[model samples]
Target chain A: MSPSDFLIIPFDDWVNFLVRDWLVPNFRPIFRAMQVPISMVLKGLDDFFAFVPMVVTTLVFALLAFKYAGRGMVIFTILGFAFIDMIGLWPETMTTLSMILTSVLFCTIIGVPVGILAARSDLTWKIARPVLDIMQTIPSFVYLVPIVMLFGVGMAPGIIATIIFALSPIIRLTNLGIRNVRTDLIEASTAFGSTPMQMLFELQLPLAMRTILAGLNQTLMLALSMVVITALIGAGGLGLTVNTGLGRLDVGGATAGGVGIIILAIVLDRITQGLGEQKKVETTSLRQTLISLFKPGAPAPAHAGKAA
Target chain B: MTSKISVKNVFKIFGDKPGHALDMLKSGQSKNDIFEATGQTIGVQNAAFDVKEGQIFVVMGLSGSGKSTLVRMLNGLIRPTSGEILIDGDDIASCSPAKLREIRRQKIAMVFQHFALFPHRTIAENAAYGLKVKGVSSDERRERALLALEQVGLSSWADSLPADLSGGMQQRVGLARALATDPHVLLMDEPFGALDPLIRKEMQEELLVLQRTLKKTIVFITHDLNEALMLGDRIAIMKDGEIVQVGSAQDIVSQPANDYVAAFVADIDRGRVFTAATVAIEPSTLQLADDTAGDAVRTMEEENRSAVYVLDGEDIAGVVTYQQAAAADRDSGTSDVPIADVLITDFPTADRDTQLADLYAPASSGLPIAMTDADNRLIGVIEPEAVFAQLSADPATPDTEPQVEADQRELAPTA
Candidate 1:
């Protein structure tokens, strides 16, 4: 016997028994309820991506990149989509996009409010900090077993696991951003008789937008990285393609799927980053940007269009 | 004048279980002793004062003296552990949160030390924030905000972000924000403390000018004694979480309540703090209608002075110097020449309330300065010697004894 045998606890067996005998039987309905929303969002986004024609999708994304991220991003988006289509990985890439989008949507809906609560109350932060640390630190594969056991091997469960893995940063950063607002500004708001709700929505949220966007960027990247690990549970996407290619030892196919994910990640990252990194002084509203885009003599859009 | 804000025996203890700390405080345990026992810091202790309507009541102290804490309690920003804060006779200290918020919105507004203009907002938006929190309509908010900005001379910068403005302009925006609400009371916590001395002086003057028309009851907090003297109608001086003295500038300078207040006022420029009336003496007069040039000279010699004011009834006819009276008597070859003919009428007269700082130019003429009442009758004379003596007296040393004796003598006749 090894030193490990000195205190044998049977922790793995306890977890296994807990999942198989108690949790799966008891919490199955609750888990199914959880999956319903994720599945509905994932299916809607997935079907929408599948329904749009390839050229129209490419042109629309290219136009968005041009409008938001400038000429360099527009050129890259168009060429990158064309390369993915040529390699016949467009459908798989679309499925992966939908998965990432769905994970982000649910993460935002849950994470932001939790973050705000944590920011407002010390007790909430005390409770949330440890859970967030665990979610961030645990290996993605360890939770896969329980997720598969509960929701059983599908796209929705994979996306659910992706959300769990990616949720921490958004919550942590949102809390930090609101907490970091200058004390003088907070006092000024309070001195002016702002209700707690008005303070949160009008002052705190607007001031913390850049930091929250950065958190969203981080969450999206984390969700994207979870794609292949999620594919182990039979989720369909470029991740499935990559896993299948790896199982067959087809290096060329695996490289093609890996390249497609990289291209899609780069496009998403650039667009979101551009949204956050606008000039702080002289911040133009979205309406202003839209108006300028359509204005006859607007210099930025004209220059961007010419460059494209 | 009605009391707009009345704070009675307010105390603020910062920590968990403030109730226990408050109990210790009420039982006469020292702040440090309670801190050692319970780890609770007393921020303000037994603070009480009444701020009259349209009065600038300045609370002045160095850092960590709890002046800031006392000011914050007035608006319910920091609730007091025990006591009453009555704003217009409504006890804000015991009011519910909703009622307190309503009070803050409609009745009171504050300007912060660092000018706390929202970084992301336009100047007009920052100015309109108080009105916005009060749920004013957008058009009226903008209109009033622009008007306030115009009052502070920054209406043209209304569309620009706070980052685009200088520190002085940002503070003006802070002032404009407070003004936009048209509050009954304004709480300013070192609003100009962050500015350089030049801008601070300009802002102080601007605030005084603004107050002439606005006449809002203002509680101004500052660490600088000179600023307190300049801007405060009445001042409360705080030290170690207690108010040591509260009085007008002249009262504090002339008779500080304790050593702490004395030391604080020691470095202040007394000329600006004291009025001409404070140094004035009862004038020796030769009646213009009855006395001659010889009598004027005789009176000056008797009084051991260079001049005697010649009064026509109660009003000053003019002043006659010994040289002018003697010359007039010699030229006319008669000791009975009229005092009016020898009277020199070009001398400057100061109002009784004129600051001694402004009396320097007239005092330089080597003649006694007349302190006149509002009806242009000479109530007293501020001799050049008295002006120099008062200005040069060092209050920080034992030598101030002679000055105190002189002050007593000056007050004797008036009393």
Candidate 2:
């Protein structure tokens, strides 16, 4: 027939047989067990976001934005949440928020330690580099079927796929940040007799914090972008709304969902980016911020006043 | 003084398999040869020296000369590939990591060239870092950190962040961090190499002033020869990972070990490097009890000198010039006038250890500056001629005959 016909090896069939006959049957239980933690956390966050009154949630988020991102962010956050509420997408938005939060939480829990390990050992980095490359570069939909076969189609599995997609940046950046600490600073710490743990916590971690926060912001953005894709696997959120609207070819509904996602993304991005850029010395603890918020004559937070 | 830190035949070869490089090196191959053959860079080679207690032992070299690498080994920051590095007789090279860390925490501290104060940390926090590593209580560490900051004249900046301070002040924080531990020895690796010249000079003076009281056994690394001569009680000149010579400022200036060392010392200001003790000639004297103005005049004439010193027992009464002695001899109308009566007691004097540069004013009187001991006894005399001779001597000239003749003339004045 053709030259190409002679070279065909049915690699797709091999992968299919490997997943269906070997991996799914033997490792399904382990995969299910892995989903349990994600399910619990996702359920808890989803319930909390849903149960909280819209006004109170809005106020709390706005206060946080004000404290970290300044008054401009505060105004945007309040108006953005109000607009989402006006569109009757509050519940869906809550579910999406929970999904993004759960994914980020899990990615940080797994990614940061792996990143630290990679930074410490050349062998670990060599092994991780290629795996992270595959996780990041492969089309997000390619692994959807495997994730579905392993963990089944649901919110937790959708979030799991999202985690796989979003985990690379945090790990890569964390490794880079820790490795890039000034050698003289490292030497100074060592010369002062800092033990390995002390050096990590006192010198390395504190110094690498800004870089790590930037990584976190990147991870958050990736997680947000994955929402619509994850919705294909039965994830309920603004992503679901958009998917349903598109199915019926309702342009207005899809645009509303798109607007809501953009609003949420911008608020979250600005807050986290501001957090990354905030001067470490000038930043007050949350407890202090709360105290200052309620204290008389302390109308604005210390950082806000300084910024103005 | 007892040796506080002793480094003996230590070598540090950087590569995956240093043993091969070591074997090659032991076979008498040069560092360049070993590197070319095996791809291993020799950081320090066969380095051996003792840093006596309270002495500033400066290891001076140009960049890539391994002076930094050698200083790092003293604090166990870089372990030697072979041989022993002993701090108070304990072999740090062979010690366990835990023991090495313990020794570093209690016995030694280091100041970096870049003033490696943590950017996120406050001045106090950076200063307290050493004590924090040692598990000191928070309040106590803060108190001690403040005290150390006070030593560096940065007590008021304790609460300020490191970025808020100037470069010199940041280095002071680095010094304060080192001093907070109050360790027995301080290792400074080109600590002022990054500062501006004016700030470097100020920091050097401040460190010397601090060393006077702290008396911490210091091993200072610098590429600047003037810095080495100004601050070092003894200097070790390193070249290509090996110490070319180790001696006091006077010794290294007057007698460089090899051509490389001579070239290195050639550009140094010899007027400041050579002290009065180094250039001083033995004094020509007339005894206060037995010798008279006529004896002074006869001695000056016989020696072809401008002046003679009058000694009352062991201590100098003053100097008697040729004109003064002859004038006294003529005015008295007799040869028995006491030498003290003609002695110019108001003549300028200097300590034997005073630098030749500092002896200029005393030498300007056109009389030999009487070099005295601690107890005011006349140990020697610094003639203007000898000062100029030593200052102007070309270090590149292989012929040392003029120096030898000058050395002989110093002895001949007293003979």
Candidate 3:
């Protein structure tokens, strides 16, 4: 036994064997089952983006940005999309946008309820808190390995990795936001005879909307960053553009992809943040006011409808 | 009638092992002793009282004295570690969730010290919240909310956000919120405690005036004894989670149950609290304006007094001194002359609720202060000495028999 061999343990081999045989084989069926919903959402988003011309999509986003973030964002979004198209990354940009949106859509659908559960029950919070910590603390790249082994190398696997990477922030913040809703308000609501569901919808969620939106923003940003990284394992999009540009040493193309990603990141971040800001204003939107008239029992759906 | 709200042997021990803490408390451990031994806080201890219908029943104590806790229990906001809270004959402590919600909606409503108005909502919306929870139609609830806001003089500001209002206005919104529910009972946990002195006084007056017409059972919590004295029809004083005493304002003020209660009541301004009504006594003798001056003098002599009130039936005409009656009699040269001409109307008159502080000028003018009813009928009279005696802090003094003994005796049986 040489010096190097003398200190060695079979930890790596054990982990490798666990993943290759037991873990992968046992969880393959579960992963395969997960593919159904994932593909459905992915395909829906892909086709939706494909049907809308790049110009139309840019204008729609610009209109949304104008509603939420104001004039500066509108201009930025319009110019940014036109630049991405001029650089011939329009198709790839759409794929990336679809992937990021799908990832966030799934994250929001899953994260919020789980966050609500965590906020409600201390036992659920106790179990969830550490799992979220582990998911967040593990390097983003580490998620790709199990994702690749289980789902194989492709856009779906990349998306699964992005979903996992982006999942923690929304859950953690939703839990925090709900928990942070003033105890006095909750007590007042309860004292006034709000049912638990009523309390959550009427008192807790409305009060917690801003914080939860902040969480969505964080989750969206994480998904975008992860999507770029996920391009490594044959996932197509802007990440592929950058990775290919890097391989061919074409700085200009890579820089263009980087600029597109940056613009998307800033635009999304600003829009989500602005949605939270709009909630702070005393005025309710005309649509919300109408919704309120129609759905009297529902909580104010201004933020919830948008996030969902 | 059944009590509007009744708390029976209620104890709230705050900790994981309240049941165990309660057992220890029942087995003779003091609150502090229990806390030291078991790390459990006794939020309320063996508290029992009945708030009558249409009464403002105040629970008063310093901070951390469980006054808030005791009031919270009325609406089942804080469940007692053991014992029962009955609201209009339904024991809320044992109520199921659905039943509790029904009781909270239809029977008892609460107002918080911090206002607890939702910042995102308009004041009208906050006021209508209870009604909304009760499944009232939007139009009806909004109407009721506006009506309640009108009661609190806040209807005009209903559309404004709660944060835009002053502290006092916000509390009015809280009060209006509670009022809109039209519940049988209102639980106010230091609802006006956060207001400034001037605003607090105004709110107290407003609440009293509102109570006159609304007639809802109110359980108010406050640390300010002056507020308790001013607002409470009956007040219960709590200390260290235990109710030390419970009685009317006069009873608690004049005959404190113990030194702790005495100390609490000591700083209270008695002149403002003890009204002309509380201090007034029956006149020793009376004379009619139509009576002969001879008869008036004779009655005055018999009563060993200088003056007599000239009564025109239940109505008070004036006060006449012996000299005035005799002089009128001599001048007219007849005992048959009516005493009405000799009657003097120079003394001060006040309504029954007039503060003793206001009565001082007239009371010290060497004439007894004449107290009148709404119809200007003489109810009773308050002398400078009587006012002094009633205002005195020493309860053991013999001269203040009517002031001290009457209230104590009335309360003794119930206490």
DockQ order, best first, reads: 2, 1, 3
DockQ, all models? 0.41, 0.49, 0.39
lDDT of 3 by residue, B1-415 (tens): 4467788899998998787788899998888889998899999999888877888988889999998888888778888888988877788899898999999888888899999999888889999999988899999989999999999988988777777788998999999999999988988988888888989999999999999999999889999888999898788888999888787887887777777777777777888777887877777545564578888888878877777788877777788888888888888887787877777877678887787778778877777778878888787777778887777767432222223223123332110
Task: State residue B190's C-alpha deviation in candidate 3, in Å.
Answer: 1.3
Please report how far candidate 3 places residue B130 from its true position, in Å. Answer: 0.7
Q: lDDT of all predictions, in order shown?
A: 0.88, 0.88, 0.85
Pairwise TM-score winner, candidates 1 and 2: 2
Backbone steric clashes in candidate 1, count: 0
Off by over 4 Å in 2: A1-7, A280-308, B282-291, B299-304, B312-315, B398-415
Docking quality of model 1: it rates as acceptable
Cα distance off (Å), candidate 1, residue B101 = 0.6
Looking at model 2, residue A125 earns an lDDT score of 100
Per-residue C-alpha lDDT of model 1 across residues B229-295, encoded as one tens digit per residue: 9999888888889887777777678777667777887888998988887888888887888999999
Proportion of true inter-chain contacts also present in candidate 2: 0.69
Q: Distance (Å) between predicted and true CA of A273, model 2?
A: 1.2
Q: How many clashes would you count in candidate 2? A: 0
Query: What does the interface RMSD come to for each candidate?
Result: 8.7, 5.0, 8.9
Native contacts recovered, in order, as a fraction for each?
0.60, 0.69, 0.62
Candidate 1 docks with a DockQ of 0.41
